[model samples]
Target: MMTSQTTTNGRLSKRVQEIKPSGIRRFFDLASKMENIISLGVGEPDFVTPWNVREASISSLERGFTAYSANAGIIELRREIAAYMDRRFSVQYDPEQEILVTVGASEAIDIGMRAILDEGDEVIIVEPSFVSYAPLVQMAGGVPVAVGTKIEDDFKVSAEQIEAAITPKTKVIMLSFPNNPTGTTMNAAEMHGIAALAERYDLLVFSDEIYAELSYDADHVSFASLAGMKERTILISGFSKAFAMTGWRLGFVLAPPDLLAAMLKIHQYSLMCAPTMAQYGALEALQSGMDDVERMKQSYKQRRNFVVKSFAEIGLECHIPGGAFYAFPSIASTGLSSEQFAEKLLLEERVAVVPGHVFGEGGEGHIRCSYATSMENLEQAVKRINRLLERL
Candidate 1:
């Protein structure tokens, strides 16, 4: 065999080059190498996929359902998702024309942005949000306009803020609740106000409600449920957070027919469909996994109480998060930056947490701790964090 040298003149896409890696990954990467490091870093449920959901996937594989599904998704799964949405949120979506299955809510975010955004179009993202939204917007040739939500305001983006952020170039308002990183959620009234703002501004709303099933104090309100909002909102949700099926990589989006068609085209070109077996599993989850979802929610609720109480006892300022598995505590008393506090906690106490700033500038002087770990682990992690704080 002769040795050959290969050279390429092609350049990588400028959009991709400008996108930065997620800051949440940094703590996880470091924690992986440390001995006995108690990680409250990643925003993932600690529970396994329920046995019934797993069995459904097993049954699909046994039946040799390993082939590709429709570019949108299996019809039965979409119908089940539609039914589930109607039953749970009273949001009716036509599965046949308004829904598309995605590899995950992550992909739904990407494709939704890709379908609607033109170069320099602005997307108002409420921060601190999941790390992916802004970069994904940038990669889709859109400008990410972050509206900072403060702890003083319970991290909820107000309608007034949304109105102020709207420019003539604004094409979308990307909102998430039961939010990641902050564990905040919006009520129906709050969401209605946002929908009104979006409608007034003539902007599409990309609502990420992936944590819809995990709320503790109140029900998750879908912006798409508001009257007149459905026509302009693309709702993205999935089985990952609620059903403990993160590894399954199944998610779906519900939108108007025209937008669905556009997103489906991009989804088809980028990802043929969500994984076949995962789609089957999600179908089962939507139909028969209500009990499983409730059980996980209760567990998370208990953990949330424990973590919040423990942090409060130690004089750390934290709110009782209404949804999701995270506790965002202010680190102002320690006089350390979010990143510095996270680093010191990891290095000194072998406890891992993500800095608030990792989420966005609004996250300064704060840190996010996930109570997704077992109660015992959460207690120990809290103790360790308290000890670290006292030494400061």
Candidate 2:
């Protein structure tokens, strides 16, 4: 656990030292210090939390309700979450025994990895993916085996690809559809292939559906909803993206009772529970925030179309993103690596984007541009990107 190498400040854990800082934040931070930079680096929504959800939290404070609930979360929130899952994703869980709310989806993923992984256990992560999966697996004493997908396949990792990576040491399959950097979504028929693989290998699955509510071309098929998968699946989602409540820091996990018990042990020891007020806000969100979510989804759809078309016009080959608010456009024609393109674009055009290589295999020679900002910003960023491409 300890490392021989020491910094002037102090010694750090070997595990901590090996993990690189998030690539998404490096450009975002640099852009923050500069003047008039249009950053598409961070994957957060630009929308504010709905007023009703905010007011519910305010009302809870006014009523002097500020104490930790049961480590699993408040019964009301958990019940609402269970109902929401059943209605929205066609999955069901017992609120009292199967759901645990955490600080955010990040915490949910971290604790879920810790709950299931033993030393040397392997997790088959589909990439290019959200940046945290491999590092979190490593942190929890598991190995991360990446299964890269091609843009030609619409960035969907096939069951065959996943099967090829499985071994006797494999324990879990981590998935994120309506994916972070690529914005690709696999339909029910496509996901059934992976579900069959999970069943065949007797492996657990961590289904990250944080972007589930934002699918544009089709309804999101929750992996757990597929036959026989619910028993072995850990479902992670939250109010952050759909409800535009990222600052609220609320997320929930659902699994079978026994598996939830294991994750709850980690939640109780490190983080006692999610924020009290945020839970109240989330409760209100589940109750009456569908309309707000719909409005935001419409806006994102519009922005997604604009970005994709703009990229095509500018000679960047971007696959049409099916969901989420990101556009991954190939920058190979410019003869620059993803990092080079992102850095040069930032410095030359004042438009910041995340280098796709940071998202892992199959991400090089491309860049991830988030369409989560306003259309005006998106247009200006595209124009700047076009200007840079012309110069190149």
Candidate 3:
């Protein structure tokens, strides 16, 4: 079934050719060549990894810890992660059998999809989601069916929307709370509705809660914590956002023993194990980094308030994001597409933001601005954005 049309010079695979590059990276690449650019494009945190966490890694290396861990991960790290889950989100896992350490949440997503999706299987993904979800599904031979959520609904996909998209081929539902690009969060009551549907349909759920600790209003409710839902949910989270450890490239997955075993098989052959020192660093973070996380979260909350208010003053309507550090303000009034707005802003004002359409449906006419940078940068960026609107 390999068609000549799907090949590039009879070389590249069809799937590889069809997948587009990340829109966020494209803008960052364009901005990188220019000087004095204030970029809000990448979702990385501005904070450094806390001194205690960094020191732990350094100490481990000093003591000769530069070796591959067990295929699952170092036992101590897995046990700590299990305890963190119980205390933080009320979900419990058996570290020895039900947890996996991955290169990043990105890798976890990839391996998780590959492990579960047979060719032609369907996964219902919530739209305006992280860029990786659909493409990863395609690469794994699963059809990604996207369900669009509205800003009017605070960008939270409802049970009804997901149910409507499901068919006999549907096998999984993917969710990201404290959603990327939108910075929205759903409460316990709202999550229960989706959980109910999953139970009814007997579908698996992938809940990406990487930004859970960044929530502003209510505590985050893990999808697995709902009654009878733990067995059916794959909970993915990491230290990237909350602990400011993006460079460490470590993330973990919690699932039922059966599902975990399948993903572990993929992980074992491909990655072997995460870096040894990074696992030690993560253990320190879990044991001592809560105060640091709290401080960073509070700073983000202040930045979020300022960004939303500044957008309002400039006449750009935005939802008050409940969590995470992104503010998606509608740019439709400026008479430009989201891509046009982002390009012009970068060219004319030296400020970079991601176009909303890149995040998929229900995302046009808006742009995503990250408040993860310093307050000074945020203020300057706001001024430049205002100038662009005025000129338009």
Candidate 4:
């Protein structure tokens, strides 16, 4: 579909006109229509919502708890979320003022940007990161200045890079640790450097920690938990990744009260509240799903091992990702670009993976393969990918 950029009249906002479609969706859509496709392209967890969580939502429905919740979400869910934060990450928030539930982390990201940014305010987006980040910043009337990280660096953005990217108009740092596409988490030293930069520059941080619960080799660090950071950071996370509740469409933000109040104004008008039943389900997840999270994480770790080993067997250099369920392997030696390798692999071997070039910057010449599927699918896809590499 053509964007509003090509509209008959000048009705669309220039900011909206400037945004590009998500790169992740294109391959997912193409793979959806094809048969015999073993897709490691999508980053969704293969697990279903746990029985306890689903039952909670069903029970809520049975009790006729189907009304518009307060815009910040049902107090119970928010309170549970607050408790979970303190328990899991040593971070605390006031459920009454610091948290606002939204449709998903996606919405929280957008509204968080909108609430904080004025026209031409700059947001430093590190890459190869999530595809939606830069577009969201631009749609919020902010300039998305991209800084890239390298494979040797384990895809972690260094303080020097962030400092170099910042300018007089720089106002926000968009951070996604256990990052999508690359699946790397930050070390304490890295975090300390970034926190120092943010503190010294007085920059606000928009931290997306959706994959926080999926870390493998290292523990996930909450940016807001850093000293001198809680007040300046707005963190977004949800049940989608850890609790396998993607279709439930629920997530929330943790920010200082005043900032949350501003985002809430935008959220209440646009979304009203997160899905009531979804919030109930999420509340259940926070209350009793730790065992389920551990199970899913173990499964992902197993799959990650297989993917990393298979890439090595094919003579592709792939760093073992510290967290999340993805492995980004370089396709440079194959004499094919990331897109060319992905497309040709799908056509020739019926194995689908995301071209890293779609993620921009350091992503070029690499491809992202998600191990969030079953062991069976992961093995088959890797075998097929290896075969394609051999033939090439």
RMSD of each: 3.0, 2.0, 2.1, 2.1
Model 1 vs. true fold: TM: 0.96
* Candidate 3 local lDDT, 107-204, one digit each (tens): 89999999999999999989898999999999999999989987778788888898999899999999999899899999889888899889999999
Q: What local distance difference test score does each model get?
A: 0.90, 0.93, 0.93, 0.90
| Each prediction's TM-score versus the true structure | 0.96, 0.98, 0.97, 0.97
lDDT of 4: 0.90
TM-score, cand. 2: 0.98
Per-residue CA lDDT of candidate 2, range 88-206, in tens?
88999999999999999999999999999999999999999999999999999999999998888889988999999999999999999889889999989999999999999899999
Q: How far off is residue 195 in model 2, in Å?
A: 1.0
Whichever of 2 and 4 has more TM-score, that candidate is 2
Per-residue lDDT of model 4, residues 1-66, tens digit only? 666655643776766766777777888888888899998887788889999999999999999999
Mark the 10 consecutive residues where model 1 has the least summed lDDT: 1-10
Off by over 4 Å in 1: 1-10
Number of the candidate with higher lDDT, 3 or 4:
3
- Cα displacement (Å) at residue 16, model 2: 1.4
lDDT of 1 by residue, 29-145 (tens): 888989989989877888899988899999999999999999999999989888899999999999899999998899999999999999999999999988898899998899999
